[model samples]
Target: MADGSSGDSAPYLRVAARLRSRIADGIWTPGGRLPSRGELGAEFGVGENVVRRAQELLISTGLLEGRAGSGTYVRAPFERRPLLRTPSAAGLPYSGLAPFGFTGTWEADSTAKAEAPPLIAARLGVKAGDPCVRTSYEFLSARQPVMLTTSWEPMAVTGGSVVVLPEGGPLAGHGVVARMAHLGITVARVVESPRPVHVDRDQAHLLGIATGSQATLIERTHYDTGGRPVETADILIPADRWDITYDIALPGT
Candidate 1:
């Protein structure tokens, strides 16, 4: 047994690398349970804490999954589906937001009169501390949580209107474009900026992934024909689960 202290790299990282190699080499098949921390510590000549950290690193990388009351195991490979994004159109149904072929249900809650944070307010073209309707959603497929989203709409845009509450009134469950159109605001385009991010504790718990797991954060906003922002949202998708694809129409096509 070799002590993990021989190299300059962190002890846990070295152990994690070796374990990753072992898994890649087929020493541990997919869904195969790994030996206990004590056993791995003994074999690696390291402390149990080091082994635990190594396992955690692998878990965050989606290479392993830990089951409560059960040992950690190699994660089984999964198909990565593509989430399609296209230009915004008037009257697009809320169901159209689902990934292709994703026959699942989503739950959403809207909080009216919520104050918009600085970042969100900027995205919505509103001043900080402005009242906004905040809606959070959890999209599930096959009963497994797949996506999380939090959207904000400036109250100034929808205040006192029937569509003020995104998930309420007759426009309930209608998408942003349609909801805005109901208010006589013509939605012209949708813009999205996608960036890689690490899932936070709350997000990880909701997505059923380890904290610090890789994910994508998409900042999406709907703009009216006059170029005024109507709504802005943060869309979170697990990196290991889906790929985002944009559908851009060519000019004059």
Candidate 2:
């Protein structure tokens, strides 16, 4: 890679661009093993570390995959699925957890009597260290992990009830609206704020992606008819694999 013409671009990024071009030109087909880092380093006239970084950059972009003890290879082509957000037929706001037409299954673990942190407390309109039930979820499509969510519910609301533990008791897995409804509470609204973020190392490992990969974080909260926040959750979606879309119902429809 020539550094003379390009201004201020990192060497690894330049190498990554050249590698990307080669992949686009079919120099390396999908699932085709790439040359060793040392060989690529020699070919690119850069250090092996630089080549490694370049390969990592490509991997983070979903253009390449690295196998343990094996070499890196071009990733197979995959279509981006749309994650639909729409209101339910009953006129309630959508949870935005499961996408429209998604046939996936989810696994969740709920911990009872957990103390809410400051941010979570603020989101739930409760004081820090308030007792809450925390549930962590991993949603999979076709047996592959596609989303992650962590939800917190105030114990003051569900305490002494069958829905105290989200994943336990009679209302297990029924969702916040239904569980609250069982307690004679009406869920009137759901508020979601989505933001783009880079996946951290732990999240990357769970999602089978590279650290620093682009993803979306949705801060979702459920409110009762009286405007009290009942539950709040943070949902993580891989940006490279899915596009988020909203379907709004017109008035009087």
The best candidate by lDDT is: 2
Q: What's the lDDT for candidate 2?
A: 0.84
Question: Which 10 consecutive positions of candidate 1 have the poorest summed lDDT?
Answer: 88-97
RMSD for each of the candidates: 5.2, 5.3
Write one digit per residue (lDDT tens) for candidate 2, span 138-157. Answer: 88765556789999999999
Give candidate 1's TM-score: 0.72
**Clashing residue pairs for model 1:** none
Candidate 2 ranges beyond 4 A from true positions: 1-55, 65-74, 89-93
lDDT of candidates 1 onward, in order = 0.82, 0.84
